[model samples]
Target: MLATPPPYPSTIVTSTNHPEPPQITIKPVDRRRILASLAATITPFFSPHYPHLNSDQFPHIPVSFLPVANARGLFQMPPVRLSNRYFLVRAGESEFESLGIINTNPVAKTSVDNGLSTIGKKQTVKAALRLKEMGACDNSCWIWPSITQRAYQAAEIIAAVNGVNRSNIVPEYSFLDARGLGAYEGKALQSVSEIYASDLVSPDIKPPPINDGTPNESVADVFVRVTQLMSILETQYSEDTVIIVSPDSDNLTILQAGLVGLDLRRHSELAFEPGEVRFFDPSSIPTYKQPASALYKCPNPPSCK
Candidate 1:
């Protein structure tokens, strides 16, 4: 009479034996993060072992001085060549003062006689300017005067013109003597009839003759002394250099010697004018003139000893 009831079979439920599934939690990612971050940064620099441009490149620059017409590989110019160490300025003329010894009348020893004239001053300025034009001012330079005021004044003008500091000028007296030159100082061929003379000494004083001639320096003394000065300069500067002044033709002689590797022919005196300067070649030298009186050097002649 009533609805049929469904059958409930399979298994009976027990409360103590049944278990529930475990839950898992997850965190959300924030667009704006509050967490601290550690970021590493790097910077760059030049290496310490890099080479300098000037040192790496200067050797490739063309040599400023070229060879002369007569001499091969020797450099000579009116204006001196530029260099890092030295620039040589050859001063002509006798110094206005002497080293305690007077060559002229005592009355002629006044300041006017001892100093540079207006023309001489101008010449000195011109010489310096010429050197600058030739590029001698890139490094330290010197103004060297013979032991005389005239040379000193000329040197001063040159220093001022060349922009050389006063401290760079030095006084050198080595060219003043004839042990450096001896009896040849003031003697002159006063008359056209006068001939060149020599200071012949007794055989006792003269050294025995050698292939290069008796030990008397002849003109070689000037060459040796000049070479010595230049050697000193080479050590100090390692560049072309100028020695501002010297007495008579001493500076010229030295320069000529250094360039030619031989003695200079002293045809005339080197006079002072401020603007006047001479340049010499260091590599090529002239040959020395043999004197008629010089005895044959050796029995063997040793291949042009």
Candidate 2:
């Protein structure tokens, strides 16, 4: 249903990039869950409401709630449609950014070194206040932020302002992480242009690896992951408002390009600044600018890169 959609509304906010996934931690199994599962099975078998029902179907195989159709054909994805309105927020400036250094390395994502600075915090707070003013929080909403310290900190500020529950503030690891700079780890902030230069040449290009501290990423690589994130969100939610917080601009820009049906190579032109917020129409066409074959890769990205 999306066709030549209108430009999204952009408001001041606070944002960064990609590369590595956060370390995973497994949680201990809950005994209560096991008992609950057993009770569901036993009660269903004995309840008068279903006295003759098949016990073999004890654990119901939840049928797909979404309608199925072949109109789009087998390899083609449905239109870029979302049940809720999404507001994209770029995280505020970080401590390293304040020093003119670029820090998208996942190893330091949680370190205070990559966290927000005074100006950045102010930016995030202002953006959150703006969202509150917009009535986005009148009903329940969810905030999804990159795992980076800066992005998560911004999420916290929004939650505090809107009174959103901490449980709804989710940390996005794969799709929303700052773009990794690989060997460019401690380089000057302006060095990001060097990476984007390669990206324009081909989305498959990667930044040089000094030693894989944080491998670099190609625009195409980011396109794939962000597309995955969109797929998940579109399928799981509806009639809701989801705030996407990123520590850098590249990921969000790439996402916007995909949303608006622009060429992937043109993504840099859509650069968004830190603490900026924007909204796009989900019914837009061409959700992802997928190519015919594999080309560039990622391991990176920096905002504006």
Candidate 3:
């Protein structure tokens, strides 16, 4: 969201969930080259022919946030000093996702047709029960779900299980929607790799506009809005747990990447399966970590392991 970074205090603020986020390495990450080299490894996930391939099929090394999205981008954004705990979650799988198709149009996504399938409903209920087990919403907690029907429904389920007031459950319309697949809407689900492939190149690159439908988006497009959402949450709440329910994996991953100060381009590596719950407990933030050299008598982080 910002081109020029804000003031730095010699040390960057990072999320508690991320002890060691991605950092610049000796060979700077070249997006085009990396994607080209990783074709055999990365391309198959989006190919229907490779249905057996796992979403996380390989050992993921962190990549630099270089394919600059928007002239000024979000990679430069430092983590916020959170006054409250935050939990990032994904809604259950949608009909399109289970059907092996795509849909990002706001109009269609909110409809009953694109809502959660039977499995999705179960998954959402299970996630809500987990939150209740953790007692995360027993106190003054707030719930924010994206505008997607599935996410909103998931929020309701969580509230129902934890006895949260309906008023405390808010619907976030903009920031946490599924990453718009743009021209790829209604296509095979595997087509998502095409969007991810483009994302590896730059955040500003919009998907090709097709027949006046859900316009595709660049990663930075999501970054800016997610940033706004985080700012609002941090500014509005304090010392309480705030659970954010997203309709898709990308929104949670993207938001986590930004909060933990990882290279925005490598956001996909921080994935969340449907109905998964992960949290950021700012109270657990450690003031610092000893350098590897000091810990294991090694010269660097990679050497320590």
After TM-score superposition, the amount by which residue 293's alpha carbon in candidate 3 deviates from its true location, in angstroms, is: 28
Q: What TM-score would every model get versus the actual structure?
A: 0.45, 0.69, 0.66
Better of 1 and 2 by lDDT: 2
Q: Write the per-residue lDDT of candidate 3 for residues 1-305, one digit (tens) a residue.
A: 86885443334436668666544335355898667556545554545454455326533523331121222122224453566778878988888789988888887768997788899999999999888887788776899999898899899988998899999999998788788877788889888787777777876778887775685778888988788887787656657799999998888877777766677778888878888988765544334455576766555857664
lDDT of 1: 0.44
Ranking by TM-score: 2, 3, 1
The number of clashing residue pairs in each candidate reads 22, 30, 2
Clashing pairs in 3: 69-204, 182-216
Local accuracy by lDDT, each model? 0.44, 0.78, 0.76
* Model 1 ranges off by over 4 Å: 1-112, 176-218, 263-275, 282-305
RMSD of each: 25.6, 22.4, 24.2
The candidate that achieves the highest TM-score relative to the unseen native structure: 2
